[model samples]
Target: MNKILIIGAQGMLGQELLKIFPQAVGWDREEIDITDEKQVKQKIIDFKPTIIINAAAYNAVDACEQAAEFELAKKINGCALGYLADVCLTLNATLVHYSTNYVFAGDKKDGYQESEPPNPVNKYGQSKLLGEREILRRSNLKYYLIRTSKLFGAKGKSTMAKENFFAKMLILSTKQIELRVVDDELSNFTYAPDLAQATNILWQESHASGIYHLVNANPRTWYEGARALFDILGKKVKLIPVAADEFSRPAKRPKYGTLLNTKFPKLRDYEEALEEYLKDRN
Candidate 1:
């Protein structure tokens, strides 16, 4: 049996990974801090896993604008990855790291492909991009750099309590009669369970090790996603579509962060995944 170690095992995607790979060893932030090089080094040497999946990331987009926060983000998202990659290389373990679609400028109308060069528009994206570069530049180990977008899971009951966008919209629908959502930004919405399934398939079946765009098929705006949630739940609410500029935040989002999967089989549609998530929620 292959020994698998999952960092950030308590996070949204991390939780799903734990469920999927129940035998895999899990470490949350409390158990191991990736930012601390000493701690990370010690843990990896102790576990000596055949596969190391880094599910941890500092993903606060707007908060990353601050000088201090940006530095921390880089340390966690960028520099920490270098440490993991180096250790994996030494241990001869395959490293699996998650990235975001934010790496693109979103200028492409059709959506970004895995081969497209990354042009991050904000501090968060830049940090993630740095991590990707670190892995390729430093590590000789076989690695998978998976880029996804708009993740939602059933781990938490509410969006405020959980980090998922779909749960947040569902929570808002119950309280607010009307909601304003950004329509200008376009991206694929991914369901965590479906993503987990695809990831496992890639790990087991695919021999090629490189960047893969793993996300639900069909691009849609945030507004459209919210509308679909209401329609699926048989809830009627006034959803107003607004441009990305309408909401002012510290970080800039890609206008078209949708990702195209040219490597593996396309995952299920966003609607199909969302419906399954909502059904499970109920």
Candidate 2:
């Protein structure tokens, strides 16, 4: 008899989560603004959900570097979690939040473990770190902090939704004969559907709530991933591997943000997941 509440249910991951838990109540930005502490508390209190899953996030990495956007990111990605955690404690409900591997400085070339310290190098990462701290600060609060990297799946049907890497690459391939992709930064790509299904498994199995890294196996660069996609589609696009510095941006990304899964079983390879996604897209 667990009543579940899904915040930010309109996004890509959130959409998959809704499909996985059809019986669960969902609230997107239109329905609820997580930044509004009072409103969030009131809404959750009224609903009296046994579990609160926060699928919302300020994921615009470059945009978050701007002062105004940084403040907004802080409120949504950071401060909002404090209120959510507070409400979870009050109602004795479990809070499941998604975090990013960006929380780490990406200094570890091999990968990061669940027990490693977080040292974010960018504003967006800093903001997500803030949310993690907010939840962890409350020792008594029942929560699950899932840290994942580059996610790819069906695009969300929301105006606020941002396109995933695979989708962007596909569109670019159709438009251009050649594409210049970054060769540096290495991280695991996660499939939204697989991650969603794993979330349900974690909940049903009653896994001890802590930090978990759920992502597809095998770490690779963006350039490599793009090449794989073109090969899969049999598209004749010349993918030129270039340094990350070639593309100037407001935010600095991690060089190696691969999140290693030590707790749960490893997921499918990103290439396999990507192939499935492309087939679905077609």
Candidate 3:
């Protein structure tokens, strides 16, 4: 039997991964500090897992622009992977990690493919790219680097969890009759459950270790996504589409960061996934 271990088990995607791989041992930051090399090695060595899935990430994109937060993000999203990969290489464990679409420069209007080179526009993206290089640079390392975007589903149980875009829109709907959302930036909206299932498929099929883009089919702007959410909920909130510059953000976001899934069979469309999410949430 292949023993599997899931780090960041309490996270949004991690929670869904646990359901997909029920036999896998799950660990949150409380169990093992991935940033601590000694602790990370000891924990994985003790578990002796054949596969290691890392779902933890420093996801505060805007905050990463600050020097202090950038360092923390780099440590968690970048250096922490080095720690995990060191152990995976030592144990010959297949390492599965998630990355963001933000790694791309976002100039391509058509969206990004798995083969495209990454040029991050922000500190968060920089940190994630660092982690990707750590895994890829190791020629002997067996790893899966999945790049996804705009994830939504159940909020994570961890304190570090932030409400996803859809959740935030829902809350704003209750408070305000009208809302302004950015329409210029484009990216796919991924459902956490769908992503988890796809990750399991990759592992179960023993797919080759390489970069993969896993996200819902359609690429839409944040404004479009909000419109879809309100439509699905049958809410009457007025949504105004505005340019990205209207709101001041600490981190500079790419105009287009959609992760085009050209590797595995395409997952269901975002609208379908969003509907399922609404049902599940209710």
Candidate 4:
């Protein structure tokens, strides 16, 4: 049996990995600190896994505005990814790393592809892109960079979907409900279970080692995404369309974070995936 090890196993994607790969070993935040290169290296040595999937990342969007956390993500996601790449090289193991589409600045009208050059507008994107570049640099190692976007899952407890910010406006039962959503921002929404399944489809095939844009096939504005989400929740929610400049935040969100995969059979359109997710959701 191939020993598969997953870091950040408590998160949305990680939780789905455990379900998809029943026998894999998983490490939560308490179990392993990905920031420490030495600890991660040692963990690999101890586990002696045949494949290592890193789902760990500093995903705090607002917090990434701080220089310290942004630097931390680079150290953990990039530096540590490099460290693990060396380990995989030494141990002769396969490595799968998760990345974000924020690597692209979304200046172009079309979606990002596996071949497009990255120009991240924020610190989070910069850090994750650096990680992708660092780990992928090792030619000898078996590595796959899976770039995904707008992930949500039931297993992910503290997700933005679970928040009431959008719900209050969507459910709109109370008179105090006043909501504003960005119409300018566009992205490909991905559910964690679907992403996990798609990743597994490629991971199961030994030859699937390369950069893949793994988000859902369709693109939607932030309002549409929220509307679909509220529809899934069975709450009556209406999103007031606004521009990117309407809401003031520390970091800038990508206007179009859609990632197009022209070749993957396992991936489907975002609308299809969303329908599936909402259809079965409780």
lDDT, candidate 2, 155-267, per-residue tens: 88778888999889988888887899999999999999999999999888999989999999999999999988889888778899999999998899999999999999899
What TM-score, over all chains together, does every model reach?
A: 0.96, 0.98, 0.99, 0.90
lDDT of 3 by residue, 232-263 (tens): 88888899999999999988999988887888
- How does model 2 score by TM-score? 0.98
Superposed by TM-score, candidate 4 places the C-alpha of residue 240 at a distance from the truth, in angstroms, of 0.7
Clashing pairs in 2: none
Ranking by lDDT: 2, 3, 1, 4
* lDDT over C-alpha atoms for residue 16 of model 2: 95
In candidate 1, stretches whose alpha carbon ends up further than 4 angstroms from where it belongs are: 156-161
> Whose lDDT is higher: candidate 1's or candidate 2's?
2
Model 1, 103: alpha-carbon shift in Å? 0.6
lDDT of each: 0.88, 0.93, 0.93, 0.78
- Residue 5 miss distance in model 3 (angstroms): 0.6
**Residue 232 local lDDT, model 1:** 87
Tens-digit lDDT track of model 1 for 138-229: 63669999999999886632232355788788778788889999999999999988887787888988558899999998889999999898
Tens digits of lDDT, candidate 4, 171-215: 443563645778898878777888888878888876467888888
Shift in Å, residue 216, candidate 2: 0.6
Q: Pick out the ten consecutive residues of candidate 3 with the lowest summed lDDT.
A: 256-265
